[model samples]
Target: MLTPRARPARAAGGAPRGPPPAAAALAPQPAGADSPAAAADGSPARADSPATAADGSTLVRTGAGWIRGESTEEGRQFLGIPYARQPVGDLRWKEPRPPKPWDGVRQAGAFGNRCVQSASWDPGYEKPSHTEDCLSLNVYVPDGHTAQRPVMVWLHGGGLTAGAGEDIVPDTFARRTGTVVVTVNYRLGAMGFLATKGADGLDGEASDGVSGNYGLLDQQAALRWVRANIGRFGGDADRVTIAGESAGGRSVCTLIASPTARGLYRAGIVESGAYGDCAGRERERATGDGAAFVKKAGCPDPRTALACLRAKPAKDILAAQAGFDWGPVVGGAFLPVQPKEAYENAGAARVPVLNGANSDEGSLFAFSRYDGQGKPLTAGQYPQALTDAYGPELGGRVLTAYPLTEHASPTHAYGATVGDRSFACPALRLNTALADRGPVYAYEFADRTSPPFASLRELDTDFDFGATHVNEVQYLFKHFGLATPLNAEQRALSRQMLQYWGSFIRDGVPRADGGPTAPDQRTRPGQVLSLRTASAGGTAISTTVGDEHRCDLWDAVPAG
Candidate 1:
């Protein structure tokens, strides 16, 4: 999802929280290759092993070194484990390297610093982060499940500029789903996606002289780490499922299109991510933007631009990158072609995919642009706003399709247009494309009364967010370590969602005992599983998403 690139209106930077008492170190267990307690990699044992520390913490040995994590009530959590070396100084913008091996146990309690980014509406990332050493991931495994359980690698959504691996507490999800969950944090914004033609070092690290997609590469590195080491955590690396929402969902699609990421995972779960052209920006356009970014950073000299960028403070570069769209770039070894092209040409990974979008995916975006700031959209200004966004021809067609009188307000009407043009239509196209290659289960999160995030709740507005973008995250996992305000019915729906997701991760199908069956796109074309509470019409196979959301009208327009 292409969110507003403008930094948050509120002040950046918040008070950093202190680590929990479980941050204490643990001793490694005495084990060898012949010991039954030893892991598959000849490392220390699992959570139930005798390696538990005096304080009830668990120690696991990785290829790098020993690390101690907390034993939670629901499962075992290993937080802040670096999957790659710190991207600082000369290492910035380069491909991620393996973290150096440690001598003793490293405390894997508190989460690592978030990738360098400005604050956003997400409560988990409301504070600006300046740290560059943020290429770490967190793993959550259930307490009793010690076998090779299926793994789900989650990528947090922050428009590819903000957010961290700790945005959601997945311990409960891990325990309930009976799967090992891994959340990751990679580089963000320009620091991750900048593709300057001449920023390579003397060693020719960026030898092509045209470099970008470092963030995408970072994600691949994390997946590679999972393949190499997840088995030690009792995770089945061969059954890994890459799942994400928004930008993270888009990252899943990009990874699906990437050749380097083929063997890292077997399946993917995409939520509200089917927007924009996954092929990414062309090399010429990205380098041109990179050149402008370099000049904006006060390093106009192409000869010294790389040195200047390397020397300038991270905050300076973050400030200079304002207004420029940050995402993956094409024509690189990481992603050689567009994702759409890859899917169409059968060049994409042949894996089962569970993909969908929220019903009113653009309401929050509309609120941010209009209602959130106190200037609600007026009926008189609606026509001009549409023209400004989609031009006169498309704007007039949109107005005819979504009349203001049909919606609660002009803002709602505008939101409907945006959601259809951006999310719903794009997602339908992706479902069709992916169904041609492999099984693709499609869904629509139609829970109109879904709870808002902490940031949205804090806003001084009375606008109704109807299953907007990111609204479904709270249902699947605890957002910001807080419980959702779900009612009895919503809670039941949440449980069903978790069950469906769990089944998808464990196997390739999404089925629950009593819940509605999620049909694959190949079996039921143009229909998706509509997920909502019993009172909100209940969950069922909905055949009206296409006509109701006006995808026919949007099919003519370009996806954002």
Candidate 2:
């Protein structure tokens, strides 16, 4: 069962802060009507005529109250609705509570504050924008439409630490595909993952005298909110498809196996994430480590832990946060068992699944370059490292599959092999497993050799990061407005990709209209579509690139 609260922040002892300046300024504006005479004059007429609503204004009814959103050209309706009550003060480390109903139309044009996070990787990270009382969601829908449309809920990825729903621009998908898109913000870091011993001494349960896995609970609250209120936005809540990449993909996998999330979404797309058995119930006993760390901080007991944490400044929390490898815990009422166990026992929702991975996932996490102290490992070092990590025999097999000699440098080889095993290979494993339960579509993005980012230009490497992680996003969203225009062939392929994705959301299958048919047409083993640049101009497709690339080899490879 799940518990909901309104304003857990107040219970924690701290008062909620007023809406930030950004949020306060989202009041709706009126649009202006243009006159034929004025248009003939060609003089820039008054921009805000009587016809338009002033900037940043919209209204939508929600489960809790009437929410007003800011307007943008991307869509007709947008609501920055608060799905769960603020988690401030006393509510600091507890599970999410339901948001209290407001008496009147609540202004929701501005984005809510993001959860407290470090400014290490993200330049937009600001202090005022980070807080404990951040449990809001943003909704985008077609303008003036009352009919139900397919809904796509997006989860952002920042390694479960940084990134906001506001960062993603839904204009392309909303305008091009005509789907209602919802992006959400959830708790992160210690605030979300910390597990305390319950009264019953169980992990992630109330018995530990504390709530745990608050982040996961926060997502559930968002989904519940969508189910209860999406209809108001002309969205068919029952047809909702949850999609995400990276850590968001990990969360999708978790939700796939989470009993609480069973009926929340009908289909799921996990890009670059895998369903695997990592740490499980028995492994969570060490969550008491938080208690020990608190004790080391000179706190008396668990009761004082929340207060002590709150009283400590944000910087202190960040500084002390080092050395803690926090993530979702199993054995909780929410999870019940490990994800792998749930998947194997057929405990997961029986829904169509689309799972795939980029060719080079580890390049994004090139820690050696970031640390600056260690030299990039050489090709000779990879085999030993693999052997050390996975044993000599297994390491030999891994080396044979990912032969470092095939690459120009050791770093390139290591990154490719690790990325394949850690992300790509496991994705294949997941698809294989899900295929037995329901219709499954699997893919591998292999676009290689794109223009290098300014940061990587100095590397002077010829290594084929082959479709490095996130490279597919450009084609998927078309947000950047690339300088080099895609030729006719490329445009055709782009349309096909978009149509496939859009159709998949509309129905359960991702099929294109009027195309060459093959044995693996749509549903067959080794059925994969390869999108590549053709010699003539735009792009070409090979029904199955695996025959040439030996993609089936991926199925036998063990996950790192």
Candidate 3:
């Protein structure tokens, strides 16, 4: 594999410092909420099963309180449930705390407020009711579930700066495959990743107090909540599996390697995201941005930075961090070391990993340079873009491998090269790293006609995204209302994928009943399960990744 990046920073004591930041311990729901008077508002629930409480809604008695949900034929959805206390005011930038108790039955009918994200260049950065009190999560339990089913908690992806979990609920994913689904919201941008004790003088310490990665810490708190509360929702907390796409996928990969997340999950699924390749050490980025925020907030004094920064309006703070890539950073007690090294040694989490990338994962990324009218790059522009992206030598090799004659245009070839280098190869590297430890099942999602999700510039730009990033997500869950539906063939592929995923979550193996007969090639070469179409050799499982995607030469490319 490509020599791993600079080793990540680690601390001797792995736990958070400064007296655990006040647990804000959540209280159980009041007994009065279950009174007959409250039950009269809605039809009283007949105690047929344990998933629902009185009032006929799919109610769950969580540690914080009783959450009343909207029950439908498809599933019982409890939305906008606060997994942690609101991270506003003094709680801002501190580790997530358990939500405080609520009064009467809390109505979980709609999605919670999305975490604040700065103005972005991608269409996925669409508008939402932005707020700092966005530590809520949603849970959907499928119908006819009497036992503890495997849970799949989803984390949405937007480069760690934007996007919300409500975009794709468990409407179809739950009903079809008998699994509980949970979607979560975490802090983003400056609110999420301000990694320094210098300014806040809180999580940051003179010694090992550099407290950044609050977003990731939020994910951990959410998972811990699931571990404690999902059982009341007919979910097996012990059988929980964490899944995410893109930045969310990176979160899953991070959790796999994080000492903080050990034993919280049984299996992990990463789609279109890997570790170390995307976000990096937060020391420099966070320090630079924190300094800028201090200046912008008019809080130059490090001693008074917290008070002054909080005094500033939310819009000004967001504007200050608009262009910065503020996401998870290495160091701190959260992600202490480089994820690759953490998972590389014998002691890393030995759970099963079902990870893969789409066939054209990088097509939509070319939108920044592609000209109008949906054509490829110009003859001169193609070489310039490649050279600028990969210096000279590697860029030339990438261009030669994907010539204009092979693809529709120069842009198409360039997109392929980007996909191979950024996503596909790194995924292969992860598979290699984890195979020796346990059962490592990798795949290639090659359904070119798959429907797309998220309101993005590429969708409206007349560009053929061609099974690009986030395309596979539509099949796993119903896309947003405005997005199109899947075709017949795509539906079949979705069923196949669901079966594989469900089996893996339930049994820690991708196949329905088998223990994954794929050879253990970590010390040598390995094969991957390719999810191609019926016509393209019918979803063959083999070690042909080198020839199929030209991974051999791409692996040798510098810094690929």
Top candidate (TM-score): 1
TM-score (C-alpha, index-matched) for candidate 2: 0.79
The 0-to-1 C-alpha lDDT of every candidate, in the order given, reads 0.81, 0.60, 0.68
Q: What RMSD, rounded to one decimal, does every model reach?
A: 4.8, 8.9, 8.2
Q: Residue-wise lDDT of candidate 3 within 324-407, one digit each (tens)?
A: 657666665567666777767764578888888888887766644564346558766887788888889877877787777787
User: Which scores greater on lDDT, model 2 or model 3?
Assistant: 3
Writing each residue's lDDT as its tens digit, candidate 2 over 1-560 gives 00000010110001122434433232222221122112112343242331221122254546565555555555654545788988776677777888876644466655677776666422234232346667888777756544578888888766666656654556566666778788888987667766666665444334234545677788888999889878767788799998877667778878888898888999887777672423232434536656655565555566766567767664555555546655567775677777777777897778877777665666654433321235676666778876875688877876776776676566666665556556765765576666656777766655554433222333445444556665555555522222224556555655656666677788877665533221122256555544444433323234444433334554454444
- Our tally of clashes for model 2 stands at 32
Tens digits of per-residue lDDT, candidate 1, 300-400, equal 98877877898998899899988888888876567778889889898899999999999999898888889878899999999999999999998898889
Our tally of clashes for model 1 stands at 2
Candidate 2 segments exceeding 4 Å error: 1-57, 77-79, 126-130, 144-146, 201-208, 275-289, 292-300, 366-374, 380-393, 450-464, 478-493, 513-523, 535-558
